[model samples]
Target: MRFLIIGGSGFLGAELARQCSTARHEVAATYLTRPGETTGVEWLPLDVRRREDVAALIAAFRPEAVINTASRSADWTTTATGAVNVALATSATGGRLVHVSSDAVFSGAAIHYDETCVPDPITPYGAAKAAAETAVNAIAPTAVIARTSLIIGDGGSPHEALVHSLATGKGRGVLFTDDMRCPVHVADLAAALLELAASEYHGIHHVAGSDAVSRYELGRLIARRDGLDPDRLPSGRRADTNAPGPIDVRLECGMTQQRLRTTLRGARQFLA
Candidate 1:
């Protein structure tokens, strides 16, 4: 199958490109900045916010599957509408589309959330992602929306941030324990996204790690894994009063496992 991954230079997108190339699938990835070369994939330039660029790329490639991994993410207006437009442009060509989203879409009230749960995002980032999901569904109901949690891998994600902070030991020793998230490895998420692209399953699906650890616990775990001192790790901040975060944002993966029939590893497993 021919595949196109937007934002292919990112942590998740890079993993997807690598996996797809390993599987011997025809893959073409797009990037805004200078993306490093991959052995078996073609990297192209694309900005999802530009509809004409999206259209032209699809027309030239004619890929059977298109995955949107691009978003403003930090800004609501750009993320919501830009993502929506990209989805519309791609799906208009009749190819399957998969929109990579976040578990932040939820307000973190429910301990366990399935695809049917309604989204009540509190932050602008969450709101934009939620709105993008809605627009994607409306444009192509058959399109798969894979909502995932904290992505760990490569160098730019939260995982790297924590590791770097600890290694440098320059910042204040304050960990936001209140900000809860399931840590999903980038390789696992990429695998799930590919599975969804190959199958006929529709609607929202979760591709996340098995364990839900607190921010403080997660720091300790990483430190432990790296042979660092967990005792030096700071205590967790208050879950409610400290900052803005999801109280309990664990995703239910029953549907994903059953549909994709793929075995997903836990956070430790990935780190190992």
Candidate 2:
């Protein structure tokens, strides 16, 4: 199987590239600035925001599957338009597409969302993700739009780094007790995505961890896993802050999990 991973330098993208490469799949990963350190992958320079560049690359590579993990939380062009470009190129090339989405697409008004739930985004980032989903679905109706939650890793994720920094007094920010998400390990997510890409499934799927945890509790779990003092991690309510996003959006992955071989481990299980 030949694979093209868009935004391959990112946290989730890198994991996807690594897993695919390890499986002896022909892998080509794109990067905006610099490529990742993963060996055995053909690293290529790409800016998903540019439609021409994206179309040219996909046409040239002619990958059997293209997994789009690219996103910029604040940039609508990078997050929304970029996804549209990828979808168009993949569809034109007749390649299978697995578009990674986010739980941010929800407004937290429902707290729990299934694969059938309609997006009601509140924040700019959420709106961008929702727009991306709509475009991908429209352009490539057979594509898999996988919506996942906070992607945690083995001390490599941003939230884990933040926990280490705050625990050691290198960073100054409170982990929100009110903000909750179903965190999935990077390995599990990447594997599940690859499985979906190789399978005959299409449409929106909820891919997230089984347990929902607060950011503060997640920080404590990270701190404990890294041998840091969990008590040193400051905690506060996101409702008290001026943060603009959902408070407790949890993706219900039971249906998707039933289709996946990869186990989406929760924060407590993975960190433990």
Candidate 3:
């Protein structure tokens, strides 16, 4: 299958691209700033914010599936509007689309946010992610909106640096005790996404790890795993801060697990 990974330059996107390439699939991954971490897959310059760029890529690759892992993350323009553009492009092809979404879409008001739960984002990043999911649904309802949790790997993900820095006392940050999430290994999530791409599964899918742990616990675990002193990790809560943050958004991923052959393990198992 011909696959296109948008924002392959990022943490998750690169992993997805790598997995597909290893599976002998023809893969093309896009990047905004620099070339992605993957080597086997074809690299292309893609900016999801630009319609012309997206249109041109679709015309060039004519992929069987387009997995949109692209995002400016906390930035609204690239994360929200950029997703809409990618969805439109995928719609133009009438191909299978797996739009990589985040669990941040929820406000953390509930415990079990199943696949059917309506998104109520709290933070700006969360709001952008929610909008991105909505845009994808509006543009291409057939697209698989896979909402995921914190992505971690074997101490290699770009997202892990902040935690490592704080654990070593190089950075100062408060780890959340009340804020809970399911952290999935990038490799596991990437594999599941590839499997979903091959399926006809549409609508929102909560693809996350099996373990639902707090941010503080996750930080301490990360610290211990990387040979850093876990005692340096400071614990706090979302309720204690004036800043906007989600409290608990643990996705009910049993439904997702039943659909795919791939197994999603917890951060504890993977990080260990």
Candidate 4:
């Protein structure tokens, strides 16, 4: 199978590329600023924000599957419009599209969300992700929109880095005890996404971890796993701050998990 991973330089995108390459699949990945270090992959420079560039690249590659993990939380043009561009290009090329979405789409009023839940975003980043989901669903009805939560890796992920920094007294920030999410392992997410791309399932799919944990608890877990003092990690309530986002958004992935071979390990299981 020929695979094309958009935003291959990103953490999740790079994991997808690495897995695809390791599986002996013909892989071509695009990077905005720099390409990933994944060997055996044909890296190409691409900015998904450019509609023409995305179309031309996808048309030329003509991959069997295109996994889009490109995201710019602060940039609506990159997160929403860029997704539209990728969807249009993938549709034109008749390729299987597996777009990675976020759990931020929810307002946390319900606290729990399934595949059927409608998006009611509060934050700008959440709104952008919701917009991307809408555009992708409209443009490519058959595409798999896998909505996930906070992605944690061995030691490379942002949250893990933060845990290390705070534990070592290098960073000055409190991990929110009220802010909750179902954190997923990067490897599991990438594998599940590949599985979904190869399957006939379409529309929205909630692909996230099984455990719902608070940011502070997650940080402590990371701290413990990395041989750091969990007590050194400061904690606070997100409600006390003016932070603009949902307090607790947990993605329910039971239905999607039944269809996937990869186990979405929770933060406790993976970090331990």
For model 2, what is the C-alpha lDDT against the true structure? 0.95
Q: What are the clashing pairs of model 2?
A: none
Report the C-alpha lDDT of model 2 over 1-272, residue by residue, as the tens digit: 99999999999999999998899999999999999999999999999999999999999999999999999988999999999999999999999999999999999999989999999999999999999999999999999999999999997899888998999999998999999999999999999999999999999998899889999999999998889999999999999988899999989988899998989888889889
Report RMSD for candidate 1: 1.9
Tell me how candidate 3 scores on lDDT.
Answer: 0.87
Give lDDT per model, in order: 0.80, 0.95, 0.87, 0.95
User: What TM-score does each of the candidates earn?
Assistant: 0.92, 0.99, 0.96, 0.99
Candidate 2 TM-score, C-alpha based:
0.99
Positional deviation of 227 in candidate 2, in angstroms?
Answer: 0.2
Model 3: weakest 10-residue lDDT segment is: 154-163
Model 4 CA deviation exceeding 4 Å by range = none
Q: After superposition, how far is residue 85 of candidate 4 from its true place, in Å?
A: 0.3
Per-residue accuracy of model 4 over 191-227 as CA lDDT, tens digit each: 9999998999999999899999999999999999889
Using TM-score as the measure, name the better of candidate 1 and candidate 2. 2
- The per-candidate count of clashes, in order, stands at 0, 0, 0, 0
Off by over 4 Å in 3: none
